[model samples]
Target: MKKTARIAAVGVIATLALTACGSREDDGDKKGSSSNSDSTSSSAPTDASSPTEAAEQYPDFKACMVSDSGGFDDKSFNQTSHDGLVNAVDKYGMQTAEVESNDPSQFKDNIQAMVDQGCNSITTVGFLLADDTLASAKKHKDIDYSIVDFAYFDDKGNNTAPANLKGLTFNTAQPSFLAGYLAAAKTKSGVVGTFGGLNIPTVTIFMDGFVQGVDYYNEENGTDVQVLGWDRDKKDGSFTNDFESTTKGQNVAEELITQGADIIFPVAGPAGLGGLQAAKDNGAWGIWVDTDGCVSAAEYCDILLTSVMKGMDVAVEQGIADAAGGTFSNEPYSGTLDNGGVALAPYGPNADIDSDLSAKIDDLKQQIIDGTITVETP
Candidate 1:
């Protein structure tokens, strides 16, 4: 049997220096790039048991997942979360099922299909699916349900989820702040930019941290690197209005480039690929989100500076494991700098960042982890 491990709440930061190649065969059907790492546990399982053994161990346990509108190939959170479900199937030999939602209208039906299929634990990807996931969880109180990028709380700050539901959320603003600082340091034009797929909290949280990081860099270095496409105070900025349109992404990026933004950050999932293309064509640097661009979209490696990543796969696999092992809890799992749940990818090989700036970014990470610095969220 594969040994079960709880995802740690705190740990030493994981090294993220990686190199890989990826391809995009179609503009509309792009898939996320790939990378590898163990779970947060100090002694995470290193080998998988035979399928026979796995089934025998968890004969009645079946895990299922539902993807948001971006589908599993989004090259962002959906892909990463799907990877976690696959990891759990491989490690635990548990039975699994999955469905993709091509639109918001399918959320309820997709989740209901999993429940009807007799899934003991269901994991839903994306913040947009929260209401549907909650409804399903409430109706099927015996089944465990976990949603990515969302927590079960109200405006007044009270937990409203059923005892069987858990949230798999990440504080990505922390790492995006680091990415912003790096962009500020590397931009020759003295300007950087960021845009999101939507104005939602999950998307804007990245923008919030990034703009703040630029501000911090200006404060410390006496440099006034301006940020375009986002204004933190107004809580407003540019957005693609959707996560699947590369055309919109590219157009928004071009607008920022035209405004003298030499570095562009796109938090728009598959749509962000267009932004990267825009940066490459315009001779600007690009910063990717959710996964390392070099690994997820290697064709743009030459122009990518780095990536702000959330360890969704690690958390998702562990959440399923908890359900399978009878150790499930409804407490929300928040990925943060202190917990190795979110990180800034190492500078790309062709990136202009130097040793001094790299070291400074590392110092910033440590400070954030140690509470010497605080990164606000939207």
Candidate 2:
């Protein structure tokens, strides 16, 4: 289901203040507690198993999840991953639990709480929880563990995770490249910008692809469209340093706007919402990350040009299903354009791209899928 929570205009500043101070309620305090029950109802099966039969088949199995600081309401990866857990519960009639970490310090405890609850499978959201998830998986060799946006390999590209742990990662650059091209095509001021919550690979991957896309557009159309934030070569650019404050996001976006950026892309979870608000105030277009902004944050649909999406929900659900059916493996799952794992959302109603530009984008997508185009991450 699409999230309906909206940030009130009057509460914007106040909400940012609370998030910055980490004053939000700790939903993770309710450890080991089931948050949902079986809600599926279907007729008895004839040959193949029905929904009711599937639920009965896994009556003793339990799946759980732990969210990063953004929690499940960020309308980004956290919420999308949690949705996958919910989908698994509905399909298998399995018990489920979740913990929301409000700070990095809570990661270890929140994951341990899932282990203590006798969870057969656990999915931890965000790259920040990698270490804690790995340690937990090592200690509990029988429990299946998966982490989103992170992998277990080192710089040398070797497998370093335990056999019970799996990585759910996405090559978001493929679609972000498309977003960059779209921004270049629609920009009236000939400048676009992008910012991240932190300087981590998960965040910079989006910025890298965006800048490259703009560069490709310039080469193709002989247009000198400039990218205000992020320099792909030096691998340095604008960042909020944290993923919780909208105020900071707005301030950075405003700086980009002052420099003549007509379009903005913010890859900073809930903090990105602040950037969108700034775009609305300044009459600039925005490209959302992680989930479709029109569906997850419909409040900003009027200003959103599109979204670079990651299929976290589908990956998480598949992970849980594997564990429930005793087919769990530690193999890493990488989402890419070729696999329908990452994609560019449909243009918003306000987007005024012509048929020619749309067709070009479609062709670019096919090229990426067929290996004719390679979207590299810096």
The prediction achieving the highest TM-score against the true structure is 1
Candidate 1 collision pairs: 32-75, 33-296
How many residue pairs clash in all the candidates, one count each? 2, 0
lDDT against the true structure, per candidate, is 0.79, 0.79
Summarize candidate 2's per-residue lDDT along 167-276 as a digit string, tens digits.
Answer: 99999999999999999999999999999999999999999899888989999999999998798888889999988899999999999999999899999998998999
Superposing all C-alpha atoms, what RMSD in Å does each candidate have to the true structure?
Answer: 9.2, 10.7
**Candidate 1: worst 10 consecutive residues by lDDT?**
6-15
- Report the CA-based lDDT of candidate 1 relative to the real structure: 0.79
User: Candidate 1: where is the Cα deviation over 4 Å?
Assistant: 1-32, 35-56
